[model samples]
Target: MWRNTMNDITLPRASNHLKADALDIGLTEFIEEFGDQLLESLNRSNPPVYAGIDNPARQWVLEGLKRQPFPAQAQVVQAIAALLLDQNEQAGIINAEMGTGKTMMAIALAAVMHGAGYRRTMVIAPPHLVYKWRREILETIPDARVWVLNGPDTLVKLLKLRDQLGDTYDGRQEFFILGRVRMRMGFHWRLAFWQRRAGGGRSLAACPDCGRLLQDQEGNLITAEEFQREERRRRCDHCNAALWTLMRPGKSDGGSRRNTVLKSMCRIPTIGPVRAERLLSDFGEDFLASMLLDNVSEFINLMDAKGNFIFSDRQAKRMERAMANIEFGFGEGGYQPTEFIKRYLPDGCFDLLVVDEGHEYKNSGSAQGQAMGVLAAKARKTVLLTGTLMGGYADDLFYLLFRILTRRMIEDGYQPNARGSMAPAAISFMRDHGVLKDIYTERDGSSHKTAKGKKLSVRTVKAPGFGPKGIHRFVLPFTVFLKLKDIGGNVLPGGVH
Candidate 1:
């Protein structure tokens, strides 16, 4: 039963291949032989404190958590911390099952690392789970500060954070949650250039720096609306300078404050369209905009003209919590968060990166995956949380490992080529750790002048199954597996999802 279940649950491995001296047993016969006691023992947690990490540090991790972890959960938390701190590993994986409290365990791991001097944690989560991540982070570490960077005002918020925040750690565990979709979403852009006259009163778009005539790659003169439909960054052939900047729609308020003010105000928690309109009418645009932009505290503590509190205490608290991590601006430009992180933020600005739904970033074609790679390089350490790591193909992990454990991958000679594409490297990784089938085909009765061998040809393709060496080298060193069964009867409902 155990052998068959392992084959069904995990990706195909070296053990799945035929072996000369392999012993096989059916599930019914094995169950009859082993009985219930052995199975029961397998479905429970083993209590052993992580080595080298003292009880005092463990207690500190536990003290900071709002909800006490079960023994099995605590074991995983400690193991992951030991991997990062003692083992000097760059990544840790949480392979917990669905509905088995994976989010709680990740939050606990963050808390443990927070005690170990990794104070700032960055989370890349699915779009739908951004608020859920914030909720869990606040629930687990009640004192921790969490920011959600998925809303429309993300660029403005990042701009403010860059200007106001200092390089010093503030002693509290801080979390910044960026939605994976928003991290790679396209931003509006336009070419920045000046007009230069080329005799006969004819003018053409010219480079802002070198005054060279701006043209497309084909050498045609550029028009003012050349980028109206699609905009991209291009460099001058001579000056080699960037010719594009983020599109700034509005520089200042244009007297139509009702729509913008009401829109931003309605984004706050518990503020409906009616209240948004009333607030705009009561306090005016500049006052409300300043409150939302500079001081959310004042808005939360706002009183009516009659000196009465506008909202109940509960509403005030909820708004304050939600508003603390968000920023609203009347005329902010759209900027991709990943681009902002790489270009504006300093390296290692975030201590740890906690990637939820980590397997989603494994796709070779996803822009989100490339953006994740950029962030992984920028962050000091990356911990990926995934229910599944591989999709039966070893190449699925090629780009993932190249992103997170880039040094190790480079040491193994899986680096990208000069063109910056890892497609060739991914093929190499697939051929190495995964199964590759060489298909040879020859025509049955085809006859040509030079076809005595029937035109024999071959093509190699990837097959399902990963090599044991790859798992031993890339997976086992960093991963911390936690099955729901391992979590045991005392921890959960004792049923599979």
Candidate 2:
């Protein structure tokens, strides 16, 4: 009986003198009855168990809750942490409603994961929330060394990490907070010339020989260009000093994003030397630099150290418009500050990635979405936190799941093509799950019989929920969803509305 159970087959009731043929028939019937279950058990053993309330990592979640008391939130933190630690399950999602303390929960998970020997965790957030994530990590885990990889100073920060890649930090926990916009950017070197402008304050050009003012024939004030244009060994009319020689010398500064943004901000109305210096001092170089590319409205109501308004409303408006026009060109070795970390930072540098507001990456083809996908692929484990995981479409989850659970996607035969791209797989996924239909429209009211110039349009009218196969393949095994109502007032302070 034991042997039969081990082989997942049954033996018929024993007879005193059983025939060999009868015994063979009984074993065949038993094999047919249990073959599917045996195969299912074997397959289950291959994949790691999904993290649930009963997972061993639940202890870490309980400990974290003790420090920051959120019994209701602890349920989610434990489940996600378990999945992240599981060898087979490297990615999962925490789909909860808004105002449910997703940030706090993510911090708790980071704390637990750090305690469990994972030293590095990176949080990729919206540009506006980069600092907010850093602040939350610090507030939650006071000893955590938080790195903000979001601003003009990000390249410098990445260089520091690259320098220390070979060294060990004795198990010190490090957290890097990055914005989504910078994931695809890279850095390069270029030569930049700093030409001296002849305008504003320093309009007078000094003679090299005697330091006398050099003026043109008009006698108002000699421009630097006019002074340097003289073919002869020019001399000052007043002192006969070498005027042209002094005006032609050039200078340059390394073209860094920090310097470029500072110079650009200084050019805006009411943001002169004094205000620019104050702005840099108040917000730091990175915050000011990021404002040029994202969330410029953050500079609307500027104030001095003494709490006085620096720029009037009209001046602030002008500054906003000016900032919008400031372009960071790649040819000039200019880049968005976040690009340096995304491009040069080593792979697997972050053991865990927490994506806050994961739904924003639903547009799989967008730059930000692609960047998020790249970062997810680099990390060892990923936890996606989102209020709305799906946008009423099966295709919405396609790219997101492909990024988070990359190994699973590949195992399911959704791999990139021969050119090392996933475009074909993405298209196949859309065709399989998305509701696509064709629309025929006549050209300029032409009749149906006159279809020579008719256009056929392929439109995706309804992107409903995923089919059963998709759910079993992409969601059920890895995802853990919790609603506010499920926790109820027993866990929450007051029942969520």
Candidate 3:
């Protein structure tokens, strides 16, 4: 006989004298024993940390907690700090209610970590909260150097820090705050122009004196003019119509702005003034604009009027370098600003990652969510601050945990697939802790030819709370839960609710 304690069931071994009834019972018991275990183990894992308050790291956290003004805040900070300071723990969730000063607690934790020798930290927040996080960090840690990785000048700031990529920490504590949108963006070159193409293959230029078109002997438009006899203007040879002098945009006279911008582009080797002009004329403004935003590779091996390659290998390299020099802007590159920093910047650029409103990245398939996942993997440690860690289902936390606590996810045998979807694991998690409903149509007793067929079938799914196994795996060891109401009256001011 075999017994399964987990399911409280027993199964009889195969024997020649076994009765049919006994065999049937054994088969049913075996199915019942193994089925529940399979579902329960999907979202289950050993405690992330075996250490208690007696552990050295916990003691250090307790010591740091004494510095907090409120006892409730101190208690919450101690729990979070313990999880973060523990070597075995990679990530932790602070599910504190709104108005609980979660931001201040996070800052205090950063101070403790900084004092413990972790000098570098990165905070990824919503666009509106970028400055707020910076302010909080400065208010909490006076000596800390905080960098805002958002806004138009982000790329410029990153370029300045290129030399300091490998040296993220230089004794002084540093914090880099970035917005979530920019986390996955990149940089590329773009061109700014004002003239629109004229119709019928003609230039917009006209003779200033007679107000007539300037054409050569072949009837082709004469877009460029040569001055004669010390006079700065050229007269059309056909009708002696004085041609308008082309002046650079924002300038009084002489060169055209289009030509000037082209000239700057030609500084790239092998891309001379002639080829540069041809590029703008051939591709037109719309094509050039699109290429700048999405298809930069189109620049290499560009075709001419005869359909031949325009750029050489050496020239392409130079063009790429020149393109990299320019900063990316809105509608300029088909990537976010943060993506550029993540991809082009060196590895280990940040030592600590702080994600504010972290629950916003619950959808693993979204661009923002995927970007956050990449960023979380790049950092040495991560802290997720959110009011609603799990909206209503166990599946809600799966992707969040997968991104921030990748090692723990891997240890639990759940890995994201090529499409970045952990559907199998999510489904198993939903089955274990999520409420399920089954619905099907049932035939009415009377089969009526004229009456409406059958009643509509409706199924409702409700996931109320995490089961014991789920609480142990996702909540107890990795998360610090707190509510504003739990904080005693001593923490709130006299007028506060």
Candidate 4:
């Protein structure tokens, strides 16, 4: 009986297998039974997590709706939060339609990262969006130390960062939000000219490279290893860079330090040279020091609501102009200058980037599109949020698609032509890349005809949004084309979600 049983038995399982798997086995079966459990166990723990606030789309939405309640839309916030945690990503574009709460979404995302202990978040927004960002941040994430980087003292703040040598809040993850205009051109001006005067009446060290502190420490600075290290390690009397150990000062003199007071005073509106001196003189040296230690809520209440200190119209107007100069092009009616801001933050700083309205960047040569590309270069993983993924033209997808998956887009062959941003060459490049999937052509020997059969070689077929010969195609893999009526079918009268 034993010999017979042995003959009927299958071979013993592999050494790696469990005793229960004596029957016939396959890879799929193995995975189903035990492999999945093993893998799940591996991911069950909260591995030292870092929540990167790249979900600007969600964050923006949250910011926009701060006065209102949180959107009941779970998918929107979830998609954005995931983007924030995804370090493999570069940039994100939240394409929710206007009034769908894009600003609030961005604020939510920023709050999440801040709650997760990530400080120093920089938001680059449109001019119209600046006050919105400030208010939303204040309203939603109350504890987040935020400062809209502005004013004549803005440059001084930048230089003072170097002096503090990382001892200051700005050195860490302080929420540093700027209007897009301020970011692009305003930033360049700030670095080029403003940085010199950033040190609260002091000057920052000249760039170790081209002497253009404006150039950013990209090409020339990267080559000099020691200087870069020292730059990071040493804090100067001005700027946000690190300073040399030799320069750190003792404590007693810290209170009277002109740079320290300047650092604290810059964030205060209307507190420039003259006003700053008066405040210091009247309140004594400990004026700002006392304010700094106050509770955030009280501190905010004291800023504008208190009648004694409102920013002067002159000061506010000057700041408005400066910020406008950055947002709009140099002239009056210019569009938001995104590219200029790219110089300040560059791409590498944020692990993921969220573009709020990705459709706005579908054009290959538009200043906004180019700016998005620059951001893409800096980010590791990118997610674009857009309801209108395609422009009426095929070329619109060229820039947007390239930014998402560069390897696949490049392998498929999409290269930009230099005639200008919206040129036919740009359209052609979209065709070369797999970005344009399908095409429908109308053939006409002598003339064209309709389905009436007068004579027709022309027809329409389902194809990709952008095709080789200036054709149209699908916007998304599975477009969730939404409308009010369709939504009303499932939603209650006051359904928040």
**Candidate 1 — which pairs collide?**
none
lDDT of 4 by residue, 1-497 (tens): 12234224345655664556556545465667798777667456423122233345545545544354333433445454564454333334455553455656556655555445444455555554555667776876665666554333334444443355435354233555544434333221112122343444544444433344433346332223233334233332335443222222223234545555554555455557676676566555454454432222222333432466344556656544443333211111222334333444444454444454557666655665666666666654455656676655555666676766555455654544464333444545644433543444554355436433233344422234444332212232212232234323444566533
| TM-score winner | 1
Top of the candidates by lDDT: 1
Candidate 2 local accuracy as lDDT? Answer: 0.68
Return the TM-score for candidate 2, rounded to 2 decimals.
0.60
Q: In candidate 3, how many Å is residue 139 off? A: 1.5
* lDDT (C-alpha) at residue 346 in model 4: 42
Steric clashes per prediction:
0, 0, 8, 71
Cα lDDT tens digits, model 1, 1-497, are: 23446422222333546544445655566667787866567445422225435456766777657787777778778887877887787777777777667788888888887877887789998765777788888888888988878756678778877885676656878899887777886556677878766666666777788988777779798754553334457887779987777765544356476677877788788999998888888998888887665456678889998999998999998987776556465554556788998999989878899889889988888899989998999988888888888889898888888889988899999987999888888988888898889999987665668765456789998899999889967887777777877766765455533
Candidate 4 runs further than 4 Å off: 1-72, 83-89, 113-120, 150-173, 186-347, 380-389, 403-408, 416-425, 432-497
Alpha-carbon deviation at 303 in model 1, angstroms: 16
What are the lDDT scores of the predictions, listed in order?
0.77, 0.68, 0.65, 0.47
Task: Sort the predicted structures by lDDT, highest score first.
Answer: 1, 2, 3, 4
Q: How much does candidate 4 score in TM-score?
A: 0.43
Per-residue lDDT for 1-497 in model 3, tens only? Answer: 55554443444655677654333345557777677886567436453343324445634543544345355666666666667775447887888988887888787777667766666788888765666777777766666788877644567666777767665456777888877766655443222112223676534445455456555558775442211213434465656654443332333124554544465456555667777787788776455544443334565657777987777777778766665444223332334655665777756566677889999999868878888888787776788999988887777877888889888778877876689667877766667656555566565555577775566567646455567777777677778877877785756565333
TM-score against native, each model: 0.70, 0.60, 0.55, 0.43
TM-score-based ranking, best first?
Answer: 1, 2, 3, 4
Candidate 4 overall lDDT versus native: 0.47
